[model samples]
Target: MKTQVCIIGGGPSGLMLSQLLHLKGIDTVVLEKRSREYVLSRIRAGVLEHGFAELMREAQCGERMDREGEIHEGFYIAHDGVLDRVDLHKYSGGSSVVVYGQTELTRDLYEARDKMNGVVIHNAEDVTPHDLTSDKPYVTYRKGDEVIRIDCDFVIGADGFHGVSRKSIPRDAITEYEKVYPFGWLGVLSRTKPVSPELIYAKHPRGFALCSLRSQVLSRYYIQVPLTDTVEDWSDDAFWAELKRRLPEEVSARLETGPSIEKSIAPLRSFVAEPMRYGNLFLAGDAAHIVPPTGARGLNSAASDIYYLYHAMVDHYINGSDEGLENYSAKALARVWKAQRFSWWMTTLLHTFPDRIPYDQKLQQTDLEYLFSSEKALGSLAENYVGLPF
Candidate 1:
């Protein structure tokens, strides 16, 4: 089968790109290795940036989200026994974030796309990228051991960090920028109620802790810990004790930690690959970059990648203009790098550093004090936290 764009991986970026292009009367095909149920159920980042919410509605994927998505006006930052809350809507000119998980967005997009007359081949095994310089670029994959080829004018890799597209670039010229932190986050979903009214980002002597909510019913929380610590090893008692210690005293007393089934221990990291595009193949979302979960950047960055690529693809097809595609890498990198820096900044400020000497800790404390004291510094943090529109 032939299409204008062949998108690999049925995650948010790939699915959303297919829907958007379909809306524009552009023909595209999506190939996913996993089942539809698996794609929609895997848990990931929530909290849609202001721009992302606008586009979701524009793309006609927001009907259910509008009904269920929790509205977050801002978040709180705590340090050195100091408390300050920046109302995000107050700064972003009334724009706000939606506390909806990435999995929900994927479900919305996939169902929306499937309902359209568009084509997506799930369980597509043996997929391979081919014929870059020709009139058609394609992927060869299998369906129950039957190999078939999908031909397209352009290809987009929205698979993720471990997918095939990132490896397609020549090893020598490919420059990978990365930083792996000493800590990891143990994220938990509890049947218990949230301790606070809004999200709390607290920096304690123990480590960083986050208190966020999925709804009035489900509470999502994360605690900084060593990457080696297994979720299995973290018994109910151990988890609550650690939480009680790291959480603010006010919330600590009230937090009703209860049974929870969904728990994940993800490694702390900040990584970005240069030139999201190489030849006829383009990379989007985690395929191009990753950020430490501290900033809640991964999902938003993925959305931003597709937003850039859609216009670039439109330009190529409509006006015979290669400029958009040619410059796609440069344009997308601007926002990606911004996020990389911001994610790194958030990670450094929130987490305790084992690498720091006594003098270094003092220096960091001095800087942290200045962050809360200086209006410019606080506003900068506010801007980064609320998000920068690309």
Candidate 2:
């Protein structure tokens, strides 16, 4: 098999990238190690920036999102016994976020592709990219017991952080910056009434907690805890009780819940790798960088990736210009690093440390208090919350 570009992983990043390129007249194919059902069923983060919505429309993937997506003006930041509202729409040039899960986005894009005669393959035997600099790169894999090999011009590593694409690049060429936070977010989804109209980042003596929603009917929340803490230790009732204690009393009035359908603890961390492009394989999304969900950045960063890469590929194909491809790494890293800073800063201030400096504790509270008191500080936060000017 042969293609202009072979994308690994059928996740949001890869799928969206392929769709964008297809619209631009570039031919590409995506390979997924996971099944179609698995990809569609894995419920994850569900927020999209307003600018992201515009891009989605441009890529022809925003019909359902337009129909059902909830647009948020900004977020509520609660700390030190007070709540400070950040107005993102006013600050980020009429920008905010829409509530839509990554899984549903993928499913929607997949269906769109099928309607447009686009390719999204599941159970992709085995796909490999080796000896990247050659005219035809070696890609080998197995389907059941049948082995196959593919040759392609460029290989895209859209598979996630743990995939083989990263490993394919030799060591020492990679420079990484990372922080494994002392806590993880125990996320849960329920058929419950939402606690707030907007996303809330609330800090309590217990730890950091978030109140958000999937819809008017279902609510989502995250609680900070030790990386080693297991859900088994916190029964469903205990979880609700803790949330009630941490959230504002007014929240309790509307905090009704049905049986929990999704629950998992995701470790909080900030990670990035340099030189996203190595020879023939170009990495995107989680394959290139990871940001803690503190700032609601993981998926937005991935979407940013599709826009960047799609433009670069268009330049290469239509104008016979490789300038964009040559600068892909440096271009993506600028925004990638900023997100790292935001996530790291938010995590440090929100999560309590084992030996937290007394002064640090005081400073965090002081900053929180200052933001609520100063319109300027709150405005700055509002812009960043909607996402850094990406």
Candidate 3:
């Protein structure tokens, strides 16, 4: 097969880019290692930055999102037995975030692709890119013992952190930076009314707990646990008990509990790879960088990369300009590092670090105090939360 771009990974990043590029009359193909059902089953963060929502609309995939997704102007930070609010709209020049599940967003992208008869090959195996540095690059995948190859002008590595795209690059050519947190977040998805209309981020001596919602009736909650803890260690009753203990009394009093629809533990980590571009292969999303869910920057960061790549590809194909393509890495990295800092700061500020010294604890406490007291501090948080300009 021949195409203008070959995208690996049918996740949101890869699909969004394929859809966007195709709308501009560019041809592309998407390869996914997992079936569509398996991809939809994975529960992920639902918070969508303002910029991401706009991008979805630009891709003509935001109709359902705009109709069903909740727009949140503020969120609560629960500390000291009180729920303090961070006014995102007031602080970030009236900007707000949308509460839309990543799974649903991916579904929308998939449907959009299907409507246009876009090429998305699922259950592809042993997908590999060849001659990345050469003018002509191609990708191959195995399907039922038969190997099929796609010849394209460029390749996209959106498969994820463990994907073959980034790994295909020479180790010496890429610089990796990573920091693994000592704890993980055990999250539960329940079919119950959310405890709050807006999301609540709780910080207690017990640990950090978050109250989020995918919709009015589907609530997603998380609690900090040791890295060693697994799903088996926390029953529904036990998880609810620990979560209630962390929240303020009034908030917990109105909390609703039910059987968990899904449960998993995800360790906190921050990672980034230098020069997201390697010849014809451009890395986007988790294949290049990741941030802890604390600030909800993971998927939004990927959206920014797609935004840059889409315009860059357009410039190259239609306008005969290489400026956007020439500076994709440096521009994407600048915003990526800011997201890293925000995620790291939020994780440090709210999470109970078991090994933290007393001085560090005091500093954390002071940080929270200062955040609520100073409008400038709140403005900074709101700006990052709604997302910086793409």
Candidate lDDT scores, in order, read 0.83, 0.81, 0.97
lDDT of model 1 at position 55: 74
Q: What is the lDDT of residue 45 in candidate 1?
A: 77
Candidate 2 residue lDDT tens string, 92-195: 66877899877778888898778778766778765677887666676776788987666777888999988878878878788887877788888888988788
Per-model TM-score versus the true fold: 0.96, 0.96, 0.99
Where is model 2 more than 4 Å wrong at Cα? none
Model 3: per-residue Cα lDDT over 1-390, one tens digit each = 899999999999999999999999999999999999999998999899999999999999999999999999999999989999999999999999999999999999999999999999999999999999999999999999899999999999999999999999999999999999999999999999999999999999999999999999999999999999989999999999999999999999999999999999999999999999999999999999999999999999999999999999999999999899889999999999999999999999999999999999899999999999999999999999999998
**lDDT at position 242, candidate 3:** 97
Candidate 1's residue-wise lDDT over 144-185, tens digit each?
A: 768898888898988899888788777874789888999898
Clashes of 2: 0
Give the candidate order by descending TM-score: 3, 2, 1
